[model samples]
Target: MLLAALVATTALTACGLPRSGPNRNELLAGVEQTAGAPFAIPVDDNVARITAYEPPLTFPAAFRNAGVLGPDTINAGDTLGLTIYENVNEGLLAGQGQNFAVLDTVQVDGAGFIFVPYAGRIRAAGNTPEALRQIITAQLETQTPEPQVQVRRLAGDGATVAIMGDVGGQGVYPIERPTRTLAAMLARAGGISNEPETALVTVIRGNTEGTAWLNDLYTDPSLDIALRDGDRIVVKQDDRTYIALGATGGQSRIPFGKPVVSALDAIAQAGGLNTNLADPRGVFIMRNESPEIANALLGRNDLVGAQRIVYIIDLTQPNGMFFAREFLIRDGDTVYVTQAPYVQWQKTLSAITGPVGTAGSVNNALN
Candidate 1:
């Protein structure tokens, strides 16, 4: 009679029983009475799997082709060391006793022109050291017989890339032979200060900007693009993250530990699911998928912008674990696991039986 009464009491109050969160049935039975309801998708199809793999970080074609300047190439704001050698005793630039005249620290102006004693204003920004030497010698041929001009390239504010953020050294580095490419420049900047798997490198040049994963920069030679003068390079950790909640071991906003995070990896990172309470059939990944992917999945095109998507992966299925391993987790996604249906029943019985047993013990003590 007591057991029957307890079961009846539990049946009456089961709706009020406290639970961690809604079960899979409640999560799906939610009525979409109005617009903007979350779409529930099962991550069990090729379309869904393909949609999960978004494009990775890339360097634009223009950035890759911009090309770096030669090691000895001159640019505006570069300092030059010029020496004019003359054979005659009476020369244009040679000192009284010396046959060669040393003109140190010749500055290139912002307009890409440099002025010599008798060579007049000449364009030096685009010319290499050897090429500029010939131009200077030609200029002094009329004033001094067979003038020999030697030009030496000097480092200054010229043709430099500003590297900042998570690097061993954050400063402006000259784009010479040692630092002409993106990888070389990053190395010259003392490598990355953070984990390479989670680090990102961004290059801002004029009106265009490009970015790539630091790890990809090493594996993919094409991503190691040429550096441009005045380019801004910043190395920083990837800000992309996702949320893990419900029956998982931990529930928090977990930052992506690497460039790519698979669903299996995400589950592992969250310390795996609570095996005692988790429903193997109710692991879900929810996010607002792109309209293109959503349309492709739903076989419709009316939807625009980002559409709500809830992806389920059932570990109970034969190929479920393999599919989870293949499904990728994107930034800002939510990974949730529903508790088994019996869990609430267990809670309800415990709730009623605990109080009943305590009251029975008090009665026995009084007797």
Candidate 2:
């Protein structure tokens, strides 16, 4: 009878047990598809395969591997200067006293073609000034004897790139010989005004857009793509952040203190774990990973959409500290530390023995 009473009393003490979060065992046991359970992975050295791709600060293929290109291609809206020299015996474009006719400030129409007096309407865009010069000479030779022609391209709105945000200068700059590439154009604009580590460089080219870390423009050779006419570049300051929860010393949305933050760094930034309440063996980082990166991490291709993943870092295991230091903490990740297993037992014991001791003290006083 006493054993039954003790069991019932102990079970009652455990009812509705308060917890900061699920312990290691409960977290592992709670995986159910119907309940929308997240996949729990143990952090280790094996995760290094996809480490660099976690935050995915890289330019797309469209902005890679392009060699240095010359900026001489004519486009619509460019201004041109033309000079025509005709034979003195019979000058068609030039008057009898003048041997040459100068036509300046000629604008290429919206259809990428320019109209010359004797050459008629000819396509100018997609052709260099020298190429257009030869076409004009060929057209004038039919009517004028020994027609000599020269075409010069002037600085105009057609060959320019607009740079803005976090740069030393925010304006549209012409793409001349020195400012043909992205690196050169950035220098022409006075470079990035923010910290290189946390800055982002995004390029918008027509319908395509790509972005990378500002440092990558110099570090990675492939990322310094050639600038095209009408390209728009923007440099943005870092705004990525993460959240800390559970038994950590502090719980809040914490900014990534640096450009790159490891798991150890994030834990320290969150004021370290709560020694009295935290279970070091059950530290977790919860995140929603993209399908592409999730596939690479999980070694499967069937998964789609943002995957809910909870990564555990057991500090008590061998080399666990090393793994934690190596693992990177991405933006929006939740750092959680479950409560120690013995904490519940201590609470239950205090709850069951407290009233009994009070009643005994009262009985002794009355006797």
Candidate 3:
């Protein structure tokens, strides 16, 4: 009898156990309440600014600017101006011409290196016109006594950076001048597709990527970075899309370029959630895995990856205001407001009554 009583007690405890934490769907719906809450903006506004420097200025020690030009960025079928400095024992004179004597005009081959009369193959691929001229001038002094050599890049056949993504015109922009800034290239590409205030512009240099907030660039004077050969500039439109399924009026995509939108702002944008049907206690916010989450998951077990998971924010709590403010929404973010169970029942009843109402109308017409 004692064994039977013990078994019965254990079964009752198991049956009475509290429900496990809410599932993914519930968590996602909860986030809708806190979707637009604002957080304290970072104090370091300079984080998004790009500091510009003039030529001959000390390059950032962290960046590699060895002044050694990279490989064959020059090619044939390109027009070049060759100037020969004739040291006539009287004085040094510089002469510029397109078709100079064999010794004067250096022809560039399919490979970017130029074949000067005396200076065999000097790599001119990534060097600026001025830099190339200096290199050739230095080389000529070795072969000829006081050999005066001048070099000019009349055609651009190498070292080009391709600009695409959210720009009016997408094409390969030649790295003509050595000191081309990101802003200049963007202008050449017909500017950004969206408003500069809301766009997110990034410069992909080799393997490293740098992000800049377009709005900051417009207001802050320091954020424009210089562009290098082979650099890629990508401009992305701000996506602030949210769904108001539960107690909000009119769900739709919010136009871009609004100020930092907080949960309160989002709710207001959604016509101040339908207070009549919304359960304030159940509001929530959801965000996809951030870079930090991805890094943490990679360090942990493989199966429990952070990249595939989403972050849920519960706004029903009083302290949720802090979280809502800090949570930022990025492009392609989706906000969904779940309908309450009672709301669903009401919808179902309305659908059921529609046919009965239609039948009644027909009978009245017949009478």
Write the residue-wise lDDT of candidate 2 on 206-309 in tens digits.
99888888778898878888887789999898888999888888999998856788888898999898988889998888888888877888889999999998
Question: lDDT score of model 3?
Answer: 0.54
- Over 38-108, each residue of candidate 3 has an lDDT whose tens digit, in order, gives 21112111311111111221223322332322332354444567766655533233334322333334555
Please name the candidate that would achieve the greatest TM-score relative to the true structure: 1
Q: lDDT score, residue 213, model 2? A: 84
Candidate 2, superposed: residue stretches over 4 Å from native:
1-36, 47-57, 65-67, 257-260, 275-277, 289-307, 340-367
Ranking by TM-score: 1, 2, 3
Candidate 2, run of 10 with poorest lDDT: 48-57
Q: Model 1 segments beyond 4 Å from truth?
A: 1-5, 31-36
Task: Tally clashing residue pairs in candidate 2.
Answer: 0
Angstrom error of the Cα, residue 74, model 1: value is: 1.2
lDDT of 2 at 73: 80
- lDDT of candidate 1 over 11-90, digit per residue (tens): 87788987668888888775242466777767775944667667768989998766666777888889999988998986
The TM-score, computed over Cα atoms with residue i paired to residue i, of candidate 1 is: 0.94
